[model samples]
Target: MFIDEVKIYVKGGDGGDGCVSFRRERFIPRGGPNGGDGGNGGDVIIRANKKIDTLLDITSKVKFIAEDGGKGQNRNKNGKNGRDLVINVPKGTLIKDLKSGRIIKDLKENDEAIIIARGGRRGRGNAYFKSPTNQTPRFAEEGRNGRDRWLSLELKLIADVGIIGLPNAGKSTFLSRISSARPKIADYPFTTLQPQLGIVDLENYKRLVFADIPGLIEGAHSGSGLGNTFLKHIERTRVVVHLIDISAADLLETYNLVRNELALFSSKLSKKSEIVAINKSDILDTETSQIIAEELSKKISKPVHLVSAVSGNNVKDLIKAAADLINKESEEDLLRLSLPDDYDAISNKGLTF
Candidate 1:
């Protein structure tokens, strides 16, 4: 199952207690304090794993705690340090403090890690209190407590190109034709329940990652349809492939609706490099297809591409164009730019089925 968001409680390990002892030997006439200091505690860390595409693994376990350090022993032997707890999540997972709603870290690259909770400091032994004026001091400090907090984890699929449009716009069909990702395709709307990733390999060994997000409808920004729930998944994409059904009566209206929903969801999303694609050209005649493409191009004031996902006509050219745009955008950062307002609130509400 694909899970994009989850909430968990994490805690660091506690420090070990110090030891109090005195040196006692037959040869030594005077014995001083032989106590040892306590060991430090372990830390709680979150790491990014490229192999993981969802947060399903982490949601199974709600609580995570690191191991505590061992206590100090006699003969000036320090205690052993606690083992660190590492939690693996997807590459685009974002961690935030649940209470304050502050972003702690954004794990964009593989192997990137952040320490969410810090361990406590070790206590000092009685020997530390011994001095020239005070002999055989019997005071020892206690170990400090570890840090604990509630954290929220949100996953945004990182892809080169994002395919978006209204329901039944042939986004999934186009993705299936180009790559190996097999998403549920049907005549009905919202066939795709989750975000699907596919790797399209082009000539000259060039490759592009395509992400298919669920379809959108009016009021999508306010959670009207599946589009609002899954829209955040495309926030990290470099370019957007706006797929529109050419056979629809009001093509321009549908296109504008999708664009307006995107703008309402995120201004950055609306401003991203977009390639308008007129899908389902196989059903329409040559003249009808050209008319619709031309009309939509003029309405949007951008170059509109004519392609048929079912018949694979002009699909390669569209993929190449998207790949070129993705290549140019890939030179920059792939992570989503930080939004002015905290988006953690939206993630906490959870996605509806």
Candidate 2:
């Protein structure tokens, strides 16, 4: 039940009515107006929780409403304010206005919170209207209504590196070998229907989050196969590992097909730093695998690594290469952030991918 998107209605609590009472004491005849003010309504709040990874829990309930305020009491006593309603979502969730399709908030960090709907104001009591000239004012203001609107929630997985390729390209196998994630693996195509996440630990206590996105077919950019559904998940990644099967008939063509789909989906995604990995080296001889890797690297104008996900051969080298690139790209990003507003024009010191 990996739900990434959902639409629901949310509303803030309504304010309570003000009391209009007149003081009536046996001893004092001129007690004047002693009405109390109404309490303010409760607000609807959204919070980001690190424990939540999907929006599946919110789908069961469609509408969310906060508690209404208590009415004012006599003897000039103010009413109690309503409690705020808090909704917890995943850290990477995005809250948007359903009608206008505008992003209201992007909860990227844990413990971050924002008020999606504000509560109504409290009403004034009759005693507030009493002036020096008007000793017995009987009028009281009514409470205002709370805010209500439809909202859309979307979740984009946060990962440091993304493992992507065509169907049956051994993307999930590579993820399971490197990390604790155990996705479904089979000899057929489309074995993985959803995205799987894993955390890989490296030397010096450094770690990286990796995501295994579902396979991409031809026309994946235009909603073909599972590519369109899972492509957006790669947008947050700093680097991507393009895994290609070594047993494919044409290695360069298979690589180019996936690249073309990525370019069509988003230029920004295609521009991210990439690492080419020729998987399933155990199926072929060492000499043949080396020759194919060398040829492919020459054709693509980039270095290629041959690794067997099942046998775990040369996998460590591949992981180290990915870690090195991640560190380099991160340093460049930090440098760009430290530069001036016109940093791009001044220097081309960012990722060249």
Candidate 3:
């Protein structure tokens, strides 16, 4: 039921027509022009809401139209303006032009809104043309049409850390062990067909959001298996936890395969801060696990942590490592914000001020 992408058509309301009339009274022999102007049409707006988690509600109907303005009446009575139409979508939704495939806006914050279509203009009445040369002008202008377009909405989940690896790498089990989220788990591959999100509460009231993406296989970037469909969900993650099954025949090859797939999908995704963890360590002896970890660390040139999700052995250490790295990166980001906007560009040129 988690719908992330949807296409819809939106249209603004049309303006009302003007009226041409002449006033006539019992006492007055010739009255002046008394026609009224038409009202303007309504606009189509799209807003972001934090409470809404999916685009399923918007899929119920494809086309959305605003209310049209009322026509002008006699006695100089103007028509009523049309009401604006507001559509609510989940936060982190990107509105794109379907025809041009260009991104219009990224709704990352709640309450953010944008007017997608503009309403037509109102028409003029005969009274507006009443001048000295044409005292009894009977001409009236017609209303203009509204704007319409086809838009595509794509949703990307926001998370602090992403848990990624090949299928059946204990990702679901690891996530369940650390957070309250309950995702379906099984021994078979592709058990998690969709991405799962969870919140891990750390010490000092600090928390981190994690997303467990579906397993990646060979040719994932090319749309093989469930990789391409769900890989985009990890693009927003600040950090990634690479989970590897310790029982794999070639640990180094397994690690490289997933990394290559990530790089192929997005260079930015592969360059993110990564934490390598060997899961299902409870099956092996402590000394044996440590030896394997050390060997893998030397081969990959990165520290390898061995943890068992089932027994909860050394899992806290892994979480602590992720939190420490996240805090470190956050501090760096804050420091960068405190500096000049061109600090990086200026420093890279080797210019001394």
Candidate 4:
């Protein structure tokens, strides 16, 4: 039950009413206005919590409201302010206006919070109305109303590398082999219903985060076969591992189908450098596997590595190639991050992680 998108209603608390009373003490002969002022209302806020991994908890509920302020008391006392309502969501959640479809905020960092709705202002009491011209003034200012909005929350998973291919292409198997992630592996399509993230350890304590997206079929961009529902998870990935089951009869068509889906979905995703891996090589003869890899490389104009997820043949080499590419990209990201904010011109030239 992994939910990445949800719509909700949020409202701020209303301000309390002001009190209009005069001091009536036994000792005092003529008491002036002693009414208390009303307290301000509470605000509605959404915070990013890294501990949260999904939006299932938030999607369960539809509306969120803050507490209203208490009314003012006598004896020039101020009313109590309302408590603020804080909603916790996973990191990478984007807050958007439902009606306008505009992104309001991107909560990417831990503990980051944004006030979605503001509280109302408190009213003024009649205590300060006493003057020489007017002895007793009974007027008071009214409180203001709180802000309300309809917000849409969308979550995008954070990963360094993305693994994408047609169904039964050994993506889940490859992920399980490289990392501790154990996704369901069956001889069928759509084995992975949800996206899974795994951390791979390289030499010198270096690590790379890989995201395994659900298999994409033909017309996936057009809402067919998962309908690009999970494609957004790979937008942030720096690299894409294109794994193909070498035993497929139409190897080149499978490659083209996935590529076209990527392009139709987004240019950014299609432009990412791919590490084409011809999987299931253990089941195929060496000569046949080489021919497939060579043909694919020639068609795509890139080196295609051959590997077997079951027998672990040439799997290390494939992983090593992915690691090398990741290292190079990671260094470039570090350099761009280290640059001063004023060096925008130079930073723009560097590639993003």
Candidate 5:
């Protein structure tokens, strides 16, 4: 029941109507109108909650309507205000208007909230109509209708590092070993249907959150295999851990195919900081692993590491390297932010992507 995206209808509560009554007190014979004003309607609000990891609870009940305000009473007694409706969703949820497909808000942080719809306005009472020209006005204003709208909700996973590769390339295996997340792993391809997030505690102070995206095959950018559904989950990732099955045939070809698919999907993603890991090193001889690593380094122009998720060989060193890269990128980002806003060097300082 990991429902991430869903469409739902929401409406604000309608305001209460004003009362129309005249004062009929025993002592006060010339008493004027004494009607009370109505209370305001409730609002429909959406808040980002870190505890909510999915939209399953919200999807169960599609329509959400707030409570209506209480009507006005006699003797200038105001009505009770309606209770506002609050909806909780995952932190990385995005809300869009159904008709125009315009993005209302992107809730990426915890406790972030936005008012999706407003409650109806309260009506006026006869007491408010007491004017010099028309002192004995009898009519009272009507309450305004609440706003109703259909909205589309989407969820994108936020992670520090993304583990991506072709089917059975050991992406999930690597994640399962490095962290506490236990994803379905099999000898066949596409064992994981959804993205899995895991937290890695390499050191007491250094914590890393990694996401294992669904396997990407050729034509993945054009809706092939798992397609772009899971690909967007890693858009916020700072580093990409590219896994290559050294035991598979044509390792470099598989790597290039995945890279090409990334370029087609998003140029910024293709340029993300990445490191190549030769997976399944335990299945290969020492000489063979070294040969493959040497060639991969030269081709990708990045330091290639040999790792075996099954034996946990060189996994620590690989993670340390990734942590170093992540720290380096963070420092550069802070430096760019410190630069003057109007400085011409800001653009070239790797600020925007």
Candidate 6:
């Protein structure tokens, strides 16, 4: 199961208690306080693992608690510290505080880790209270309590390009054809209920991650169909590949409907860099495919590519074009970040939807 969101309770380990003992030997004269300090508690940590794609494992186990520290021995031996508990999640997982509803960590890169709960401090032994004036001191500090909190985990897929369109628009097919990801393909709508990621390899071993999002309907923005469940996965993408079926009636109207849904969902999404693709060209003749592609290009005022995922026609060009656009956008972003104030104004041109 592909679970994106989950709520869990985590707690750190408690500190160990201090030891109080009096050494009694055969010939020893004055045996002062022979006490040892307690050991520190264990912490709760969350780590990002690239191999994980969902929060399914975490959901199975709701409550997570670290081990408690061992108590001090009678011979003035310090207690052992408890081991930390590490939870692994996907690379794009976001950890939020349940009480405050604030984002604590956005794990975007692999191997990134954050300490969710801190361990308690160890208690002091009675020997620490020994003074010159007071010969026999018997006071010892108690161990502190560990930290505990309720956390919410949400996973947003991180991909360079997101494949978006209506149900059965060949988004999954395109991903399977270009990359090694094999998503379930059927002739019905809503075939893909979850987001699927695939790595597309180009010439010279160049590669890009592509995500196939679930289909969007007319009321998708308003909690209709799959609604905004998978929309968040596409928010981090650099580019969106809008795939439209060429065999559908009134292709331009279908394109506009999808665009309107995107705008309603998020202004940022509608303004993101987009590449139009008319899929299923193999089902249509040359004249029909060209007409549909030309009309869509004119309607959207952007370049449109006619390609068939089944026949593998123009798919390579489409992939290359998408990669090139992503690279150019990255370069532009870098330039904007590095340039001075005067050059910043020129690079701040508003996005064209």
Q: What TM-score goes with each of the models?
A: 0.91, 0.92, 0.90, 0.89, 0.90, 0.91
Residues 89-126 of candidate 3 have per-residue lDDT tens digits of 87778899999999898787789999999888888889
- For model 6, what is the error of residue 41's alpha carbon versus the real structure, in angstroms, after optimal superposition? 0.8
Query: Which candidate comes out best when scored by lDDT?
Result: 3
Report the lDDT tens digits of candidate 2 across residue range 1-353: 78888898998888877888889999988888888988888999999887777788999999988877777777898778878999988877878899999989878778999999887878878888889999888888777778999999888877777888989999988887888777889998899887788777877426777788889988999998764877877777778999999989999999999999989988877787899999999998999999999999999999999999899898888888888887887666733322100000001111111
Clash-forming residue pairs, model 6: none
Candidate 4, run of 10 with poorest lDDT: 339-348
Model 2 lDDT-worst window of ten = 339-348
lDDT, each prediction: 0.81, 0.81, 0.83, 0.80, 0.80, 0.80
Tens digits of lDDT, candidate 4, 1-353: 78888899998888887888888989997788887878888999999887787888987789998888777778999889989999998877888999999989878778999999988888877885668987777876666777899999888876667889999999988877777777788999999888887777666425777778899998888899888788877776777899999888888899999999999998877877689988999887899889889998999889999998788788778777877886777666633322100000000111112
Residue 82's C-alpha lDDT in candidate 2? 79
The 10-residue segment with the lowest total lDDT in model 1? 344-353
Q: Against the true structure, candidate 2 has what lDDT?
A: 0.81
Clashing pairs in 5: none
Name the candidate, 2 or 5, with the larger TM-score value.
2
- Candidate 5: segments with Cα more than 4 A from true spot: 27-30, 204-206, 331-353
Q: Candidate 5 on 1-353: residue-level lDDT in tens?
A: 56667899999989889988889989988788878888888999999887777777887799999888778888988778788999998877889898899988888788999989898888888999999998777878777777889998888777767898888989878887887777889988899888787777755325787788889999988998877777777676778899999977887788899899988988867878898999999998989899999998898787899999999899888888888888888666633322100000000111010
RMSD of 1: 5.5
Which is superior by TM-score, 2 or 4? 2
Could you tell me how far off, in angstroms, the CA of residue 164 lies in candidate 3 after the best superposition?
A: 0.5
Error of 5 at 281 (Å): 0.6
Candidate 1 vs 5: which has more lDDT: 1
